[model samples]
Target: MDIHTLDLNFLTDEAIASFVVESSDGPVLVETGPHSTLKNLERGLSDLGYGLEDIKHVLLTHIHFDHAGAAWALAQKGAKVYVHPFGYKHLLAPSKLYNSAKRIYGDQMERLWGLMEGIAEENLISVEDGTEIIVGDATFIGWHTPGHASHHIAWQLGDLVFAGDVAGCKIKQGPVVPPCPPPDINIEDWHASIDRILGLKPSRILLTHFGEVSEVETHFNELKEILQDWAAWMKVPFEQGRDPRDVTPEFQAYANGQLKAKGLSEKEVARYDAANPAWMSVAGLMRYWKKKLGA
Candidate 1:
């Protein structure tokens, strides 16, 4: 089996990535990116000598638009869509998910995500922890790893782990950055989830936000450290009773400084920000602290 990274080219180059695992049985796609990039995904599949219709299985880490938005489209074409059980309802009827994202993105929703159509129930496979998903001769073990999103799962195939966001985001020439999107960011759960990933002892991690990461132990260590730092940074603002918007600039500045110290150019910082917004991390971590304090 060979894994290929399909650059979704969302907003910028190398910002978002989806993986295509080529197997003798058929081609399997992991992460559909956003529906807006379906054309790019099709083109990528074509490059691999496969077509959209040739994709027999579609495995998703989560149902976030950027990750699994195109699963419905593929499912419509007879591809089976596998997702975390908690996310099954949303994919079955994505109105709530679509509407919720609309509130966040406003006018840019459709342009950014295209539109999320519902995946038929027959085509939807709700997976749980320890679920083994077999794609032809290839075998993938799905483990429920939350904190990024309750519906998140990290798929393990041989030595490779499709870590989704549990392993954090690492763009080229930058350090690992935690992706703390809102409504489901739990620091405790995230730590435990990271431990779960470490237990796997994977040689390579495939991130949906970007591409492959080979420094397994170092990557996990950095992700844990940054997760702590970001959470701690948000705790201060939360203790002062400051709104997330009020501290976003400060957090962004701090993060920018840290990234600069690591030798990332301004353009690289901007590209990283484009893939994973700093503001969302602030809000998500603030919410996590509030929940921890029983507020």
Candidate 2:
């Protein structure tokens, strides 16, 4: 099984994806970056001696624009796109997804995501937990891993697990950061998902934010700690009657300080900042807290 990392130069650098298990039958493209970086994705595939036509199955960790936006393009090439069942309808008709994103991104939506057209129903496939999908010679086991989003899935191929945001965001030199995106960020569920992935005992974890991480135990431990920290910090502001908007900057500052304490150099810290922005997680964390407390 061949795994290729396609670095989709989104707004920031290092927002890469892993195209794993490529063979004559066809290559499985995981995480299609954003619609704006389709050219970069195509170039990456071409560099590997394949094209959109060679991708028979596109496995999405989640349906976030940055991760699964270009899957629509691949679907046009007759590739079967597989995503979580909860996210299936949204992909078929991205109006709600686009409108929700527009609320957060506003004017930057087009610039950041380009155009996200709906994927044809015929080319769309949905899988729940414990569902095994065979694409060519490779077999991927899907686990309904939520926490990052209610519609997230973590695919296991052989001893390697394609952990989307379930493992959190770990960039070089920075501490493992949790991406608790809004609408469905459950702290308890996130912790359970981590345990579920760990139980699989995969040899390597292919993180969507960057490359492969072999330090499975240490990596999971770090992610668990950071997730708790972020959740705990976000809860305090809410309990103290602080505005969500005001708490965002505080969370950013706290996260930056934590990164600095982890001994990330200026250059390494810059990469972390570029790869995973603190505001995005802040919004998610705030949203999670609100839902948990019924605020």
lDDT of 1 by residue, 1-295 (tens): 7889999898888878999998778888999999999999999999999888998799999999989989999998899999999999999999999999999999999899999889989999999799998877899999999989998999999989999989888887589999888888997888899899889989999988788888888988898898988888888889999878879989999988889999999999888778778889887888888888956
Highest TM-score among the candidates is held by which one? 1
In model 2, pairs of residues that clash are none
Q: Candidate 2: misplaced stretches above 4 Å?
A: none
lDDT (CA) per prediction: 0.89, 0.84
At residue 63, candidate 2 shows an lDDT of 95
Stretches of candidate 1 off by over 4 Å are none
lDDT of 1: 0.89
TM-score of 2: 0.96
Ten contiguous residues with the weakest lDDT in model 2: 11-20
Best by lDDT: 1
> What digit string (tens of lDDT, one per residue) describes model 2 on residues 62-169?
999878988899999988999999999999999999899989889988888878889999999999798999877888999999889999999999899999989888
